[model samples]
Target chain A: MIGAERVGAAAAEPSEAIRLEGVRKAFGGDEVLRGIDLSVATHEVICLIGASGSGKSTMLRCVNLLEPVDGGRILLWGEDITSPAVDVNAVRRQIGIVFQSFNLFPHMSVLRNVTLAPIRVLRMSRREADVRADELLGRFGLADKRDDYPDRLSGGQQQRVAIVRALAMQPRIMLLDEVTSALDPELVAEVLNVIRELAQAGMTMLIATHEMGFARDIASRVCFLDQGVILEQGPPQRIFTEPREERTRRFLQSIIEAGRM
Target chain B: MLGGGRAVVVSTVSTIVFFGLIAAAFLFAPGSAQVRQEFFNLHDMKVALVGDPSHGVFSVGEAFLRNIEMFLIGEVLILALALLIAVVRQLRGPVFFPLRLVAIAYTDFFRGVPLILVIYTIGFGIPALGLRVVSTQSAEVYGLAALVLSYSAYVSEVYRAGIESVHESQTAAARSLGLSQWQALRFVVLPQAVRRVIPPLLNDFISLQKDTALVAILGTVIEANRAAQIYSSYAFNYSSFVLAALMFLVLTVPLARFTDHLIARDRRRRQAGGGR
Candidate 1:
């Protein structure tokens, strides 16, 4: 199944969207991402699954250039974004990232939050940005919340607004770092539904998620990270079902026992 | 649980008793009568407040206008200058090292020296230079400049604290959406940071308002404090000083209360889990 999926992926999109080659990152003395190499094709939805502190979010952050890599290079659409000459702001423009905590600008209304990057970074006129933001917000069932502050919204609503804010940039790819993790259990489904809608719309995404079931349903490929490396990866069907790495099985067992899957 | 009405009654009674005892202690103290005669004379206070200008006594009320003018101008300059310094200090990388160094030195020098010394230096020392443009400025200008310089250092630190208090994740989120560092600071980080620090900023402004009195040391400014000093010396009574103190309290007490209100609102907002 993994082999067939790769063959089809290559045929559909001949170019890679994001490629990480031996990416390494450390915070203080702790090396979070020892060496990671992964390639994501256009329109591909790759889910990174791992335990806490396994460097899933770090990998996503490094891809977005939010965290500078200690070693190696990251290429976005065949251009080496990690090169010294590459402008980080310009590089970040092509990729949008939604965070776990939904770090919306608390001081801004939802419309302003969504329109900020489009106006400032993209240089879109305020009116144009507002129209784009409104469309995105309306699509995500957040149209009524356009003038509301993030604090006025529910956790799920804020996360959805965050997604709309990222989408307003019209980024080539989106990185979701446990976007639903901060939501209440009841609120989680609303945020997850938004991601599912994005997936259906064929938005290229690299998602760091704890939802094993969601990963099995939405991801083209699932990468299980262990101790700062991609320990195992395959089509989600194969990775979730087959006996491969003992660590992967143990991780799955714990999730199953915890009734999360 | 204490009943609501009973709790209010208890607190009101306790407050009155607490203050009444302190008042009685001062009233019955040795030489209280002498102190009252000198400092609390209603006639002297009225004379100082409604000054007999024909008799060469500057009205404390009229002279207080100068303090207000100094405070208004100095407060505006200090806010602008301090924010600039705070933003400069926030600049990163090797290229900004020199600018950052200058900002650090400025805050250190001003904060280390007393405000009065700065006033003395800027007021007298600048005139000594005999530089045509600067030397010709009024005593009020020199005094106001000193207040701005000194208070800016303290207020810049407050702004810096606000900037630093904003979580790093806010910056990350902004940057990831393709905002430059400055754009992030201007739009995302600063608005939240400034909102968070407003209570403290108002607290600093209250101090700045009171410190406006310090300009009287220039001798030529003739602000409320100077007027009070002159009146006290002439009448051999300190009641004029009490009137000056009341003037300061009239301005600062409301400001202090406003600051408290801001702090309470901020606390309530946070406790209610984030709102404007």
Candidate 2:
């Protein structure tokens, strides 16, 4: 099963940055992801939109090799990251992920938070890491907050710092897992603006978000996940206006009813 | 402001009256004079504390320097060793199963045994083995080893609790940044864990300071309690023991207060919604 999937993926998309074929994940007896198959091309931004507990986060975690898949394989730029021998830390270095809650190191200053991975994992010199971190923080409008701890920053500032921290690693692909969900309504736009800027810069990204408007505005393709599988996927205009699957329509209708869009 | 001032006045008056009544009752007791002569005699206290060298009497105040030395050395060793054990126990994967079991057994065995028994076993039993260098060590050294081994077990549990209290998301955040497991623990988890458990760590140190008295059980090591015992037997008065108790209080009371201050500051920080 794995071999056939690999051949098919290789033949179909030579430039694909990430591909998941028949990926499955279970927490104990409860299956969160059941046979997920998707491919994201380089420099494309694909957004996964679904209800809570629909395995969106788990799917992203699997692609990052944070969650070990129960079955099937995950390929990163044609490399099989799901293999038991693959070093998870090396795989994660290439794929940067921003979480729903900004999990900044509370004990560290913002500059240290952004520079830590480069200094520690990448073996960059302290001065080099600091220069890179400073540039990223400046780009994100957090230059003045470098010495401040996470607890001292507003929700928006903290999330922006988290994004810059991820970006500092110079990752090939970025995964954003509901990065703005924990922010205030007013603060969401600042974070969304950083992501929009990243997308415009042509950084390949896979995002799982609840902001329908933001997803519709930023996504190159929209994927509707239901019951741990991609129920429907297409260009944003068609998927948002005329979803083919009933579950997709229902999920969109509920999102609209809740006035998220 | 008026109500607050009135409340303070009432509390102050009540505290004085409550203690004054107790003092009067104790003063009028049938054996109060005898008790005072035995335990609060100023001349005997001065003699025990400063030493009547002309009379060949040992000074408990001078001997307390040994307790402080033992406490200082034992404290440093316990912190390093307990943290090592705690980290070992936290190691994952099947390959570490044997090491994890050893850490668990070490803590369980040392914590379960009486400290005094541990002191006796190390001081006498090891010397009885008749090894060349090991058996020739002083009773003070053996007693110190026993304290270090026993206290490390308790302190390691405290360290473990602190490590567990850190949210799992913190580890996930560190790992997702491509840090190795050991790197994540060393740079991220441990700093935060050690911060959160400082108050409890200080509390344990206070106990350790007092427990240094147990070393005198080796019969030849002249720590404060042993010196007190000698002076009491020779002078036929208990004032020397009171002097020794005061010496311990001088060191431990300040530490206890410092721990309370740390706990209060931590509570305030949490209530302020900071340091999440």
Candidate 3:
């Protein structure tokens, strides 16, 4: 069982969990993340929704400090993570990331993939790491694939292994960037099943995904991001049936209509 | 538009005309003298023909052939040395600026200068500094040493370019999995790079075949070109020289085709997303 109190350190209140103010990032002339402010609460699964190139991925990346922000402050569990003196690596260790492409190490076995970071970065002994890795693999129903390489597994199996890898690190917050986007239509459910399981277990998760059903079903709150801003947000049921913002209503209509026709 | 009979007739006529011109030029040519004196040629070097040089063209000595074989063994050793140096240089310097700089200097010096000059400098000039001319087994050794020294530079850069052709993402993926830079290169990059470089390396090996001719300048008697010189001097005949030319083609052409086959195989494998 996880220590829920520390986990909520990641999400005490919408204001206290992740506080970002006037956050900005740019590469050359293009500014991807403009000045923005947002908060996420404890025991919450916040789904970031947006069109392509709308900066939803960048926002998720920012939370993990995978992409450094040029300005503003990112506070994780009351610690000012944006300070230059802060060890970004330590912050990264607490915040785990899973990418859309399922960037699993191709050269490692499925078990090794889950075990490497714990043994290397966490400095866990090999035997202990192996023990933890086996337990995790069994939970994900990948015990048979412990010795198989990433290339040998199905895309769904690989992504599940990826999630287990992040989970093995025991991160306070798990940042999932379109985790099922690369999966085949039939395979998407397998990966999403694992994500749903994590959300139910009270993982502090921020997911950038296109699956509206997943957002409506599992998300505590949903934020529609467009042009690098949070256009609108609310409870999944309210946003789905009674969106107050025009942009959120229009986005929902497009997806529902696309599904119908 | 033209048919097969027309092609055959044209080929037969051209063949007759070519042979006719050759016969007319050689047989009916003016003042082609046997007037060259025997003193102009050293018949003793004709030792290569009968594997002997006891009294020159009229005689054969097995000792000369043995010396030539000894020289050949030495040159092979030199080639091995050069290959080792090039591979080591490539493996050592994919990232370090200083290593790259040293590589650039090596290839630049060797490629920028002529091979004959490199051979002569190592062959004769080094001996003037008390290197003692390496007259026995070292004759072949010194020639081959220069050959390997000159060629290794070109081979190293070919390897470097092959290494770079592997995408940066491959390394990034490996490192993200907790591998160090060298480990990433060793486990991910170099294997693919080496496979891709095989055609160019084989091409390098072909160049090495002809480059062996440069050893003649250093007085090694192992190789065909030098053996040609020895045969011509002893019997005063040019047939063996022709035979040596034929032998070099026999070795190089087939090897080059085999290398081409490997290149094509790798390209096809890449198309299918197989490992390099």
Clashes of each: 0, 0, 6
| Predicted complex 1: CAPRI docking category | medium
Candidate 2 chain A — worst ten consecutive residues by lDDT sum? A1-10
lDDT of each: 0.91, 0.92, 0.72
What are the candidates' C-alpha RMSDs?
3.9, 4.5, 7.7
Q: Model 1 over residues A162-234: C-alpha lDDT tens digits?
A: 9988888877789999998888999999998988988876778999999999999999999999989999999
Chain A TM-score of each candidate structure, as shown: 0.94, 0.94, 0.93
Q: How many pairs of residues collide in model 2?
A: 0
- Provide a comma-separated list of chain B TM-scores, one per candidate: 0.94, 0.97, 0.69
Give the distance in Å from residue B237's predicted Cα in candidate 2 to where it truly belongs.
0.8
Q: Which has the better lDDT: candidate 1, or candidate 3?
A: 1
Model 2 misplacement above 4 A: A1-14, B53-56
Ranking by lDDT: 2, 1, 3
Q: Residue A108 of model 3: what lDDT?
A: 65
Better of 2 and 3 by lDDT: 2
Q: Compute the lDDT of residue B71 as modeled in candidate 2.
A: 99
Misplaced by over 4 Å in model 1 are A1-14, B1-37
Candidate structures ordered by DockQ, highest first: 2, 1, 3
Models sorted by TM-score, best on top: 2, 1, 3
Candidate closest to the true structure, highest lDDT: 2
